[model samples]
Target: MWSGDELDLDAYLARIGRPGGSGAAGELRPDLRTLYAVHRAHTAAITFESLDVLLGRPVALDVKSIEDKLVHGRRGGYCYEQNSLLAAALERIGFEVSGRGARNRTRGDSLLAVTHAVLVVTVEGEPWLCDAGFGYQGPREPVPLGRPGAEVQQGEWTYRVRKEEDGILVLCLLRGGVWRDLYAFSPQRYHPVDYVLLNHYSSTHPGSSFIGRVVVHLPGDGVRRALVGRELTLLHPDGLAERRVVGPDELLAVLDREFALRLPERDAAELVRMYPAGD
Candidate 1:
């Protein structure tokens, strides 16, 4: 029962580094320009990380807690927290937003569960996809929603919206000339409570990958940086990439300097333990 009343519009804007007023006093519309501005700014400012999950803390999906954690607390989170915060902000910004459940195809092809979340927004009677989550695979700007075979190319990344035989829509990424499925979702609407259940599973279940791994992602000027259990990768748009296994001693500095996170001493020490050297 999110009334969309809990978000602090001013604080949220500051958190995303879009603190300036959008325009004159007129009500803002969900136009393409505004959507791109918000989406890109949100993705750039916030990051995709699993610090709470890694530290064995509960993940909150409510609007108040989300605002407090992501906006006021100045921290990053995974899909549920990230998209939930984005959806709430978009609603307050006057967008026709629908929260949808999805399955991560990267995890497997074995009839995956709805472990991911995304937003389908309508602007001027047309649907567009916007997500601040999805880490390195997230779009830099909102992409038009289309049927199978339709594609949107942002720099080096090529994303396609494909409709499966069962009428499920999947977002695919083209990498190294191969089309890899990112996630699959139906038009089925999802609610905040629904995400609470999904979030609990993702954070607590022993089978969940987020339970023990150190995953951090932040989009840079022209590259996406990701750290997965000490293996740091920098993927550039021009097919250039670099990777190295980072040591535990440098993990905190990387999180602070590279990802722009200011973690508490306890959290920082715990993260170092979570991703120890040679892990």
Candidate 2:
């Protein structure tokens, strides 16, 4: 179970720009409206990045470590940290939250390992797929799990969950009139320990996509952007993607401006030093 009691709920809420008080805290009830609001605010405020992994630092899954780095420190994180923090917040709000390990399906025809971490939140006895960590292509709000193959529109983006023949639920996105598979997850409940193991492989394994790379993504209503290595790609709802190369001199600025991320002076220098060597 997520350590909701251990999390500083107010701090987490404030970090996402939703201050927890009589005004806002009163609205943080365990319901669909609060779930959608929190999920949207989180994805809008915190970016998706693998800077710690690229810096060779251990990505801790604990609520404290994640709160320190992401909430207090004003830094971003990958799936585990993002969804873990979210799950903790929702759980603290008296919502039913669970974990699910998902396999990345956007890669190709080859099946990949179960590395992605997502959350399942139950509201009024109905489960909703609440993911704030799928990068630029992720959902901004909770996608209802009760209705499969139903189009759920979050702003201009369209997403749907299809039930495969094997009972697996695959999340798909509509891009340029095509339904592209984003990732697939099973109903098997994952725990914090499971994420710790998945985090190890993703942060250390040679085959990991995040290793030796500068990966950052920001999801938006009009445009979704991702910075992979030196190339920066902007994706639109119509499936039009524009790519451009980012020079080393502009790296930090791009992260700050585009992703709303600014590292410390020391970390900035180190990331700049390692930027040229990235893939």
Tens digit of per-residue lDDT, candidate 1, span 99-131: 889888986657778888888889899888788
Predicted candidate 2 versus true structure: per-residue lDDT over 1-279, tens digit per residue? 789889888888888998766566656799998999999999999999999989999999999999999999999999999999999999988899999999999978989999999999999999999999999999999999999999999899999999987779999999999999999999999999999999999999999999998999999998999999999999999999999999889999999999999999999999999988434
Please give the CA lDDT of all the candidate structures.
Answer: 0.81, 0.94
- Provide the TM-score for each candidate, comma-separated: 0.92, 0.97
Q: Superposing all C-alpha atoms, what RMSD in Å does each candidate have to the true structure? A: 2.1, 1.3
Residue 188 of candidate 1: its Cα lDDT?
88
Q: After superposing candidate 2, which stretches have Cα over 4 Å from the reference?
A: 277-279
lDDT of 1: 0.81
